[model samples]
Target chain A: MKEMFYNRPKPLHIKGRVYKFGDNINTDIIYPGKYLSITTEREEMARHCFETVYPEFLKIAEPGDIIVAGRNFGCGSSREQAATCLKYFGISAVVAESFARIFYRNAINLGLTVVIAPGISKKLEHNDIIEVDLKMGIIISKKNREELKTIRLPSSVLEILSAGGLVPYLRKKLGVEQ
Target chain B: MPTIAEKILARAAKRDQVKTNEIVMAKVDVAMSHENADVVIRAFKEIGLKKVWDPERIVIIFDHRIPAESEKSAATHKRIREFVKTQNIKYFYDMREGICHQVLAEFGHCRPGEILVGTDSHTTTHGAFGTFAAGIGGTEMAGVWSTGEIWFKVPESMKITVHGKFKEFISAKDLILFIIGQLGSDGADYMAVEFHGSTISEMTIASRMVLSNLSMEMGAKVAFILPDEKTISFVRERTKKEFTAVLPDRDAQYARSLDVDAASLRSQIACPHAVDNVKKVREVSGLKINQALIGSCTNGRLEDLKVAASIIEGKNVHPDVRLLIIPASRRIYLDATKAGYIETLVKAGGLVLNPGCGPCLGAHQGLLAAGERCIATTNRNFQGRMGSSDAEVYLASPATVAFSAIKGEITEPC
Candidate 1:
């Protein structure tokens, strides 16, 4: 049988430039509630994803950019839009010291790579090219050629990311009868 | 053995009990979104998720920063509209719909014996209907979008039983504030609170929502009301969907149970910085106010607005106070307007804003300036929560807030 959503046999991989931030990067700042009325397209959202925290975010973000931040990233409301906005804007993954529970689940379910890399916020700089091996919990900056930083991931989460997210994984695991 | 929350989570994961810090996949019965739908849609594209797991279970509301308050907000709205169309997700409410929590309950998205996760902290409001609802972050919400499942840590249960009848001047808001004062901000961190007793049974669903909504301020993961007849009737009226009848077992265990005598309770206030810094209204009686706001997912219901209107009726707000009134939703706004409560509020020198999260989140409308003092009917008055970090917020019942607006100081209604 084909592997279901986010149910890859191996861990997922993410390579992107880093966008570092502090703790408590709330939903309001990520995708400010005020902008909900505008277009829902990824392009439009990508333009404004981090417009508040950093005005030049969209211009600087590459297709596979990653966000590295302090503890409690995505600390406000359960708006999936905060994670979605980052994804919409081409953020391949978010590596934070910690994440608000709901945001962590949303990112994973949506298939946006999310990892907890304690102290990554301090070592990474804006636009730093980094590669993450989800199964191995390893992050390496090709530009710096420094020793790889390792972050731990549970086997269960690795399975989900490998399957490409929940829906596909469930379809494979539970069968797509419905 | 596991608690109800743990039991439900285990069933979702097809497990017996989920240990702490173990990531277990489970389904999200409901996923609510405000103006930030665009971001979520974007995440879907980046992750290459095909579609929302269940579009019908998705409720997208436009509450915070309504009326396209700015060019940036207008862009956000456009993104949400596009996503809604693309996903073919139903249950979309525009800016006029009202706060997401109120609309979710009124429209019947929340029901008993289910786990509902929202993208807002006040999603706990759904507990009034006996559903296990909690807030999550956007990334977590994205996971719910793709798989419809999320993880949870089994929380220890704290049972709070409020018995007896509430005095005329004491409302549910005061009752919760009083509890917070006793428990402190981190009092119930990572715990589930079960509100029981005669008073809870006697209170209306709207009143119960006020209590549950503020549970987040106490750092609780979930605040729940045991299913009763009121819960049954509420669900029956809202949807034709079936729900499992959920109630605590006779021999169920609890971490602790505290009995609160409501009849002897007084109107209470939670001072600035911490919700646990609570005091009786009379204790802080003469403190002047720069603003008084009555609305939020917590206390912004028709019943709450009616109570506030009654207090401020035929009375002018204090010259020093800027009184603001925001209805919980469009339905509530219409009901209040039809009942002449809007006129009463306007006549009392109050400004009525559109039905949205608005001042409650300090995003738009009625945000206080530095060193300003505000008495609000909303939940949580933590430092820097409303506007400036120095701005002080005093939480109170709607009536008490309205009366304070009239007196320009925190005061109990006569």
Candidate 2:
């Protein structure tokens, strides 16, 4: 078992296609308040994910895709549903300039990696295959065969990602029964 | 050497001082959600998370947009039913239950000296019970759902002392609004505000809940009243649970201490675009309103409803103004109905909405159109926060909102 929650010194390689977005992507836009009562099934939620913000998101999203967005992504309501819907759809990670405090914490706690990459959203395009080297803070696009950018993660958040999430990480560190 | 919030957080995390911006993993004693469970479940599957760290620690309430206002909302609730069953999450409350904050308090979910986080901003309501509670985003909630632990930054502290006795019709709501008005919306930004002094000690738990619930409107990360006899009695009556008292050390320091003289305060209003844009009701008198809403976790208590009923008895709402009254919870609703408060309000031309968020979130019922103006008891009046971006929301006390409804404009309770 992992003894503590700490990010690996070496990068975890991520291979995925990118899904681009604009600023102020709120929880209501991610998973509209209207569909909040629907089932938690992955298929059910993935269908409605971004249904309002980008009506064609469901049709275009492929497994192992990445969502790149502008600042203040997930700005309203601490609805964990926004993160859940994205994870349900098999998205690999979310890279944005900034995120609402609660949404940022929720994403990391659930074991879904979210990186803060300032200005990367402006350079990215939909369906752009990229490799994210989290440890190294580097993004390399396979489509263009070029280095897109590098973004750093705070040491604390890196620890969370390394530990797989708060529960397992804390369990190991506290020596508690899991 | 830890700050007060740090000490409590450390006890929960079993650590010493959790430094600023440091991610210290700690178990979540309580995780509350509202009307957003479907997306949370979907996140669970995406990560292939199988079980909650602790099901009993989780609370899923369908309060926002309740009554399945639309076909889409209905479908969301349907999804929640299935998720709750499959997970056996025992704390789930259906639409008929009530708002999460009120229900949580009534059901003994909030306890003193514990750390709590909700997916709703009004989660600060738990602080009235003396817990350190704040709101977080859905993704972070998903993280808590999986691991039951969250990160934190030990915040600085601010002590707000309310001295003097309140005049007639002045309430805890007025006191809080007055404080925000003086300090500005971001006055206590990212700080823990501890409410102290004799007047704070005299307030009922319901009234204290109103005070802490709106602390978020002023951008406070945490707001709590000191645990006292009233708090003890409330916990004892509600949960039969015993707790050791937690108080700040006499020598403990605060970033600043704000002294509010309640005796000199009148009912106040937080104007549009910002909660800190406060003015005395008399200062804003004659500002006509199209609606008056009294509800939200902030002021939806039986006491609040009773106050409104008292002012509206035998007096109809302004014919030009639409008045909406909603209790914070179904229990409060039923109690108000049983006591004839609901009838009194209805007879006085107030529309009684079933217990839920209602107009507070601007989803259904009582939303204002462009150029409309309303006096509300709910927290937050940011631009377009209530309905159309062009509409204006003036935040005030339940009494003030009721009085305004009758007068058709902002007015002092004479």
Candidate 3:
């Protein structure tokens, strides 16, 4: 049993204060297009994230804050900065009813944690303490005693996440990034 | 039963079959990019690759920020040009070409059964040609450049069946907007949406382009309008290269299906800040607009220009509205000029801009100020998409936009 457990990775958990948003929060609303040509750095991209829709998002944002959003979160543009901005801003994870397809895949490719929990948006308030267990596929709302089940991530996605995004994963597979 | 996406993806994967949710390293037919090629270049350099896998299979068009809107854009374009020259890429188009998607189809790089990946989301527009096209991040695109292959999780298929004839002024744009409204933004999340039925069958290649372009709004991984006579004819005009068409199995299993009655649908507008926040044109008719734009990858084709010209001919644009017309490509621009569409539009007080994605993505051209509103033929209506966060954009068809440009407000054609 000890030998079998030696190689098992630890379960990943994220606990943070929630920053809530409404449905169909698109990539433009997350990272406006005007700044695309200017900001080439992830840290620079983080500064402009949600600056258009929520003007004070950057000012009030803190490390380990999680975004709780309604359905179709991150829709519209396929800009990966929308996810990168949040990730670099120290957002631990995004818990939403759903995510736009490209943005969801971009997040996974970037190793930014994203969780899908139906009705999770309505259950949490701004600044509510929430905990998410990626391995267990569950979310616990500290505001209330109620618990919510999250969509279990596919094993392939889990593999990519463990490898720290597609770039690093490809680096390893190509045997280049020593 | 396999869908068009599955068939193309399977061939690219070189596998007997693939199932939904299964990851496969499918080979790429073409890697497309725009001004964002600089970003891809940086990622490629980070991957420690001195040369791309295949120079012939990469397509770069300087459409998004053509003519270098600012110092930043100019620098990015310089880097992109340098990279293109050094790589000896043949399919690269300069600032005067047009939108990436439109140019790709016009030049015959996109064909049925081929797999295309790009750095822009609207890359899905190529699926009008029945290609397995999807958008990826810059890093992922860099991987494709290095390896000529990318991974895909086969998506569940959704069939959208359209029937009945469209009423006058109810173009393909209206039908797609209606579908997006019904499906919501995430309705087709992680799924391949296949447009089928009589309406799609009768659609021209340009009209089918409108449907596949806006399908991105519904969170589709890839959108498809299967090959038909119109498609084959269109492909024949562009390229002499032989290619095979991939079709969905007769009994292909779709996880979800929808029915659209085109006859009953009205002219629709996606209101401020959301593509799915759609309503019939009558609901907000006469609402004042300051700018009326009739162009973008979504509706900037020659057919769209002809429709707008037919509507605005022999009439002046409203004094309050700035009516801007931009054709999708230089070829379309020349064709429109040959057909007198540009003359009718300009004579009617419309400003004909250069043939590119001018001001569509809010990088330059006609950006609205605070408290202003625009009626555009562009795909997105997201908040701040056109300029100021306080400004609003209502998306409609070219006919609706032209009609509204005359009225300086949102209105359906009488």
DockQ rank, highest first? Answer: 3, 2, 1
Local accuracy of candidate 1 as per-residue lDDT tens digits, B1-414: 455666666666788666544556677788987765655565454445567789998889988778867887887788788888888889899887898999999898998878888767878788778788888755456657877877676677889989998888688998998898888665676677889898999989899998889887666778888778888998899999998856766666778778899999988988875567898888889998999999988888899889988888888999999998989999999999999999999998999988887776667787778889999998766455577656889988998998899999888877
Tens-digit lDDT string for candidate 2 (A94-127): 9887765566766776567888777888778888
Docking quality category of candidate 1 according to DockQ thresholds: incorrect
Tens digits of per-residue lDDT for model 3, B65-113: 7788898889888988999999998788998888888999999988998
Give the lowest summed-lDDT range of ten residues in model 2 chain B: B39-48
Model 1 alpha-carbon drift over 4 Å, by segment: A1-76, A79-178, B14-23
- Measured by DockQ, the strongest candidate is 3
For model 3, which pairs clash?
none
Q: Relative to the unseen true structure, what is the C-alpha lDDT of residue B277 in candidate 2, on a scale of 0 to 100?
A: 80
Error of 2 at B138 (Å): 2.3
Task: Give the poorly placed runs of model 3, Cα more than 4 Å off.
Answer: A1-11, A142-147
| DockQ per candidate, 2 decimals | 0.22, 0.23, 0.41
Candidate 3 is scored at a TM of 0.95
In order of TM-score, best first, we have 3, 2, 1
Q: Is candidate 2 or candidate 3 better by TM-score?
A: 3
> Residue B274 deviation, candidate 3, in Å?
1.1
> Best candidate per TM-score, number?
3
Candidate 2 lDDT over residue span B47-137, tens digit each: 3466777888889998888787788788778877988888889888898878899999988888888878887877878888888898986
